[model samples]
Target chain A: MKKHRTSPTTDSRYKPARPFNADEFGRVRRILGGKVLFVQGDAAVAYGALLAGCRFFAGYPITPATETSEILSQLMPRVGGVCIQMEDEIASVGAIIGASRAGVKSMTATSGPGFSLMQENIGYAAMTETPCVIVDVQRSGPSTGQPTEGAQGDIMQAKWGSHGDYELIALSPSTVQECLDLTIEAFNLSETYGIPVILLTDGIIGHMREKVVLPEFEEIELTWRREPTKPKEEFQPFLVDSTKIPEMAIFGTGYHTYITGLTHSETGYPATDSQVDHHRLVQRLCDKIRDNRDRIVQVERDYSDGDKDTIGIVSYGVTSRSVNSAVKMLRQDGLKIDHLRLVTNWPFPEKEVAELSERANRIVVPELNLGQVYHGVREAVAGRSEVIPLWKTGGEMHVPHDIVELVKGGVK
Target chain B: MIVRFAGFGGQGIVVSSYIIGKSAVLDGKKAIQNQAYGSESRGGECRGDVVIANEEIYELEPTNYDVLVAMTQPAYEAFVPLLKPGGTLILDSDLVVTDKKLEPKKIKKHAIPATDIAFKKFGRKIVANMIILGYMNTLLSPVSESALEKAISESVPKGTEKMNLEAMREGIRLAREGKG
Candidate 1:
């Protein structure tokens, strides 16, 4: 997080004229010159991490997501950061937590099986209030079902795979540009709330290549973890007021910070048996995100101009692209349809979906898996509108023709 | 326009489509490039698709193609049927044996022995994709020649750029001469 740090450049004499890091960031800006870069979604995530001031990355290589780590391994050192290929996904998550504890922005990328292995540590990160980013480029799974194909089966696992009932932030990106933009936002939200943020991308979006313009350096905004203002002797690691987010003291900052996975009080020590302390600790861990949902949750409402005759479609990730194309086709045929694209999948956009239900006669949920997000949408709709599930699996995305046909039939 | 490049994994099918997508963007158009293949690195059936548009491309994956470039027999058989009516089909003549009975009416077909030409001229069959790209661009003009040349120069292996650009020019010459 050092703004004054110098980039390791080949030419020692050539220093950056601008204030930003020159070696990598300046070269990227100069070369691209606001031109579109044709790159895979995975590469965009890696670029997003570097732009967001993430200096530490640790991950086990997996298909679809391996490209993210691969690109970062080459780019991280150029920006004077450490990128480690850990032996396993569990160790990968552990390493990032340690790095974030040391006060450097950290991240890890993985796919389904690897993501499953990181669940315990994810819970630990939440309990320890570590600010780190985990990218899960999803694949067909229950196990290693299909390594190369994309699926949205892990939407539920992202929020509930861990043992505890704690809440976290998860974002879903449908396009390559969003892959870059949302990943940067993931780190910002993680640091802002002191939580482990999950970036839920899929194999399709991760593997696909598209043209995207990298944001100029001046346009980028980074969020760093809040530091304790008190002196080292008087600092309490978990102390907080109305914000419900503690100020983190770096590991070597001479502060007596005791971080543990066990439920702790404001002083950051074990309180394993005290029920009141455990409830208070867990409630704040979940409340910090829940109370800030208005600031956190983002939902894109498309064609809201659709009248009462329009059918409402709710989707996220790669599946949402099909919904977008399908809505266009249906609208062309003089059919009205509204789309709710959930950019923030976890703090499910219940209020917005309920609002959409009130406007439309029926709602459709299209997902890559069989009814993961559909159930959540139904619960949110609360029978205000009929919720229909259009599920497809086996790696291929739902085609726009299929969505059009389904919605067209609903019109009848 | 939606174009598809179909071949085995080692034939540079994916990179060829990527070059077109990049060239289109360089020419100030929007494009998306995507592919489907087995886990194997080589000798497996593969297909890469690119969608280009002046406006935003809502279709992430296309079901049919406006143009098809088939580099192998299986690839031709698997994808040619998906070509839109009145679309164009290009194939490597030495590799794919076309059946007039199965070919759709009102469709233009161009058969170039790209692999043989690559081996004869460039001494490398891997540059066939560049040749097909040149021929396709000459016929369709989806992207400018300068953009295509720049994309190939930036995309190919460092030392191979000169040979790839030469191969592309040969295809362009062939198209101009109406030889393939």
Candidate 2:
């Protein structure tokens, strides 16, 4: 075995760059804008990250998700950003966390197997309250089941994969345009809440090419983590503020903050033994997201008529496209139906789901997986409406005709 | 409009749909293109699907194709049934032989020897897909001529624009004269 250097500067090969200025941001927009580029979903995500001001990327390539890292590797250096292909998925996520803590937006993209490897670090980021993004271009898997086939099997994994109780934000994109737009939203949400945001796409969307009209930089809204306003001596890294979020202190900014995964007090020292400290830290972690759930969750609703007899269909990602088309055809046939598409998957959108269930006589959920989100829909409806699941798991999308047939027959 | 290009792998089937999708976008229409292929690297059946619409596309994949471009006999047999009634069917006359007795009567058929045209006229067999695309351009003008030309130039290899254009024009000429 070769002996490796252990020094901080030598052990880690890439140093995090400073935040991008207006000129650098302008260059990124120019590189991405001006024309409707017919590009793959993975390329759109890479460009979206650059436009969202991500200056650091660390990832280990996996099938279906490799294009994201490949494009970033070529483009990051051109725009004064850094892309590092780490040794493993754990190291890839760890490096991005380190970069985020250094006051730069950072990200990593991977598939199911790589995502499984990154869970420990994902939990670590949550414990440390680091702001970063992770893109999981999902593939069929329990353990590398299919490398190239698309599946929504990771829907539940994305929310509950990491151990311990914590809140997560996940957004699913159906189109290549949404892949770009939602990626930018993922970065913004991560920065706003100081949490790890996951853009849960799948193999089909990752590999498919579509027409994407990117907006000008001036029209796009961007948000960054708020800097600490307190003086160096008064800085408390873990203190909950009026907004229920702690302002972050940059590592090299002379704030002298201690960062660790252990349960800690407001002063940032490890308090692994104290029950009250652990309780406080955990509660803040969950509450920061739960208290602001109204502002964080996004769902698109379309109703044929505001009537209680309609059959409501709930879906997300690529499956939603089939559902939308099915609903349109059913409506043309004089059937009453509607659709509720989940844009933000995590935090569950429990309230919206419950309200829709109350108005809907029956709710149908079609997913690429066996029945992941169906369980959530069943629970949220709570017997107010009959919940049905239309599942397909053979690495194929549900055709609209099949869905139309199901809706016509109604739930058994 | 939903169109499908089907052939064995390595026939540029996927790229043909990609060019159509790119041209649709250039024409200010919403478009999406996706593909399905077998695990084999080459010679396996492959299909590419494109959906172009004046409004936002709700269905990512077409349930029934409005136009079908069949470049191989197997592909032609497999996809011809999925073509909508009265839809246009473009086939490579040299590779796919349609059964007139059993074939649907309502469809409009345009059979062109795309491979022969490419090899005989452009001195390359690989440009057959471009030739087929050029032939389809006449039957269904889903995108403008200029937009299709720009999309072709952007999609093909860096230094082969001139030869590909020649192949495409030859295909257009065959379609204009109703020649197979």
Candidate 3:
């Protein structure tokens, strides 16, 4: 478990995103000193990428998540980076992974349908251990159920979206501020672990606005993939060195690295031989994330005491925001309760959540999806506490008042 | 506070809500504005909602709206039930002629001659939305005049800022000033 740190550091709280200027480094370094700006959830997703130093974004237009792509389209280009609206979502993901291999921070965004289309590429990125970020602004539907709606249905898809056994990093933001911070974190984890990071958001949080104090564009730190200082011939793209990360170099950079969707060795050439390289490659792919859960996993608990006297609410994304408001309302009405709003959906903050669930009267999981996070909550607590699932489908976000009713033992 | 504004095509209803929305943003309040106008070049029925509060607002749609501003009869009739008890309902008296069924005491319906004032007084019917926004400011008083002026100045593209600001002021005067 690696140490986890999040942003919009206290200093950035009071700062607004300023235009580019001189003395920016010192000013921004000091400015991230105050309160964090509040913005809508999707804006936060877009901001997270911006803060993470993501310079390359290729995405196709899709609802809900389109705002994330649109904001990047405007901001990335102005910052001397490239933002391309590709022909479709698959091409968008393909471009992002390709750009990431080129040693630049890159990301692509989409909704549920587009997300489904990107799964094949997601598996390829996993097998190849390519580093990048994918933002899925979840909507309601198995297939275009609701365009102008919101849903947490993609929660399971994000984890299992790409077909594979490899663990992933999927952070769901309930507010715009988290979007900004988590986007940066997504990039960081992607680079750090050598895997594609998913920043999951529902339509409600993605499209809604909240007060966000964005540090000037240049003020935020961005991490690009580390390039090979070693000569091209000496580089092993999938080398099983101690660091578990290769000195990545892009194809056009004179690195001459072989690229493929097939299983390959450290040298980048496709090989069917499992004894020498294939086994090591797959293990490293999984180890990259499994080994760094702490640094990669991010979660937050508000009023989570885990007492039997209190019925706890577990939720993420927009549901978490509603739960926060509902908890406040319930408390005012004299109902004792606790709320755990998950910022990171995958990597399931097991230890902390398990500890909290042990003593709580009940753990009620509410989400825009049918019952994705509830599965993790149930497995984590191991039935120590009652695991109730409050699932919502389509795009309508589960309101806070509804959560209050559930907390009082109204419905699961 | 959740505020919903509805009107017909080219009624400046979206523009009116934007003026209020931008003013809130200028005042540094946590504000969010969402518009649902038709994709058609010519609008059939267009509507938008603005949510502003000291704390974070989760609901996107106006729930028990604090204020309702409408430009056409359909706009007023559609939004009447949504008004919270004791909420303020402002409309373009000249444009909205239909009698909508709404609780008179619970909801205060105040109609101002927005089109008449814009066309007859300013000789520019296009500024009717700004006029309605101006009148809205007088009744709601949620945002400061300086902030609204600043908001209008920046929000309305560079060339049209000055005229829109004046139209806003005139609209405010029309609604705020006492009966002659």
What is the model-wide C-alpha lDDT for candidate 3? Answer: 0.72
Against the unseen true structure, what C-alpha lDDT does each candidate score?
0.87, 0.86, 0.72
Give a tens-digit lDDT track for model 3, residues B63-103. Answer: 56888887787788887777888888888787776464554
Please report the candidate that would top TM-score against the real structure.
1
Best by DockQ: 1
lDDT tens per residue, model 1, B58-84: 777688889999999988888888888
Model 3 stretches astray by more than 4 angstroms: A1-51, A68-77, A216-220, A304-308, B60-62, B98-100
TM-score of 3: 0.89
True contacts kept of 1: 0.81
Order candidates by DockQ, high to low: 1, 2, 3
lDDT of 2 by residue, A1-412 (tens): 1112111111111111234456777788787756578989999999999988898999998988999999999999988889999999999999999999988899999999999999998998888889999999999888888898898999898889998888979999999999998898898888888899999999989998988877675656677787877898988998876677787899999997888988888888999999998988888889988987887888888776656788889999989888878987988899878788898899897888897887788888899988899999998999999888899886778898888888787443
Candidate 1 off by > 4 Å: A1-35, A306-309, A410-412
Give me the candidate number with maximum lDDT. 1
Lowest summed-lDDT stretch of 10 residues in model 1 chain A?
Answer: A1-10
Cα lDDT, model 2, residue A258: 88
Location of the lowest summed lDDT over 10 successive residues in candidate 2 chain A: A5-14
- Per-candidate TM-score against the hidden true structure: 0.94, 0.92, 0.89
